[model samples]
Target: MRLHFHPLSPYSRKAMVAVRLRGDAVELQEVDPFSRGLRTAEFVALSPYGKMPVLETSEGPICESTSIIEYLEEQGPAVMLPPGRQRLARHWDRLADLYLMAPMAELFWRRDTPLGLKAPAVCRKTWGLLAQQLADRDFVCGDAFSLGDLSAAIASDYLVRLGLEPPAPVAAWLQRCLAVPAMAWTVELAEGHVQRFLKPLSAEFLADS
Candidate 1:
């Protein structure tokens, strides 16, 4: 299996973490989505929608971060989805993707616009619910890290750089999630990409200031 991903993408990071945790020996193929790498004929053939984090499996290519993770779950020890907590994991994963990751991406790329300005508020609203859910638990689902924690934690990490810090409970939970080796490795890889992407913008801001 070959996983096509970009380090800077939260969804891709989520899939990568799942692959690592599942102990899959998949090859990692880094693609620059910003450079139209996903639009190439070879990549588009694997993923018609041209999305990052496509897993090329012997069965076939799987697109969408969640779908790839789900497919991995079937092929491995079910560490990401678990047995009884599958529903909760899926629920939080969807919520994180929709409420946290989606708005965070908008804010990231359009930080100077009105829509982007409002994005942080949307993230905060979701973080409020996440805070409540995480108050007594180590992770979104419970003691064990699951898919529930992956998407939310990755998004929160990036959102912090955007000036939208998670509340106390969620902040602590984020730390615990990052402590996972796979999560830590992916987040560190993403930080390098993010810094490179932000350096020019930071210089522009400093010049204006």
Candidate 2:
């Protein structure tokens, strides 16, 4: 199996985390089909929407990050997601993608669009909501680490980049997630890409140290 993904894509990071934490290895291929000069029909065929993080399997291609995770779970119980509480985990993943990633992408990549100017405000509200929702939990879906927290950790990185200090509870949650070894590895995969595309990277994420 192979995963075609962008190194810094948060969606890709979550799926990658799932694969690694399962104690399995899949070939990884990095691509940037979204770049104007790099786009190609072959890439489009691999992913109809020309997106990154498509998993190529013996059966066929599995698109979408969450769908790929679900495929992994169906194929083996070694999936990183917890055995139960599927609904809650999925909700956390969706919430991060919607509230956190959406605004971060608009601000970082689509700055010229009309929504760009409002990105800060949108992210502020999102941060507040997530902070409140996460107020009493160490992880997104309770005390256990699951697929939900994996994606949320990546979103928390963007939340830091957004420059609004995370609230106390959220900060505590971020600390716990960043302390995960897999999270550090994922961030190392992401840092260079983010530094190349957005801003200077920081080493503060090594919270375990």
Give one clash count per candidate, in the order shown. 0, 0
Model 2 misses residue 153 by how many Å?
A: 1.8
Cα lDDT, model 2, residue 80: 57
Q: How accurate locally is residue 72 in candidate 2, as Cα lDDT from 0 to 100? A: 88
lDDT tens per residue, model 2, 1-209: 99988778888888888887776569988886456412677777777887778899989888899899889888787445675778878887887787777767776676546676565566567667767767787777778678777666787786576454667777888888887877778888888877777742234421211
**Evaluated with TM-score, which candidate comes out highest?**
1
lDDT of 1 by residue, 96-189 (tens): 9999898778767766676555666778899999989987888988899999999999999888776665789988898899999999999888
Q: Could you tell me the lDDT of residue 118 within candidate 2?
A: 65
* Global CA lDDT computed for model 2: 0.74
Determine which window of 10 residues in candidate 1 has minimal summed lDDT. 200-209
Quote the lDDT for 59 in model 1: 96
Backbone clashes counted, model 2? 0
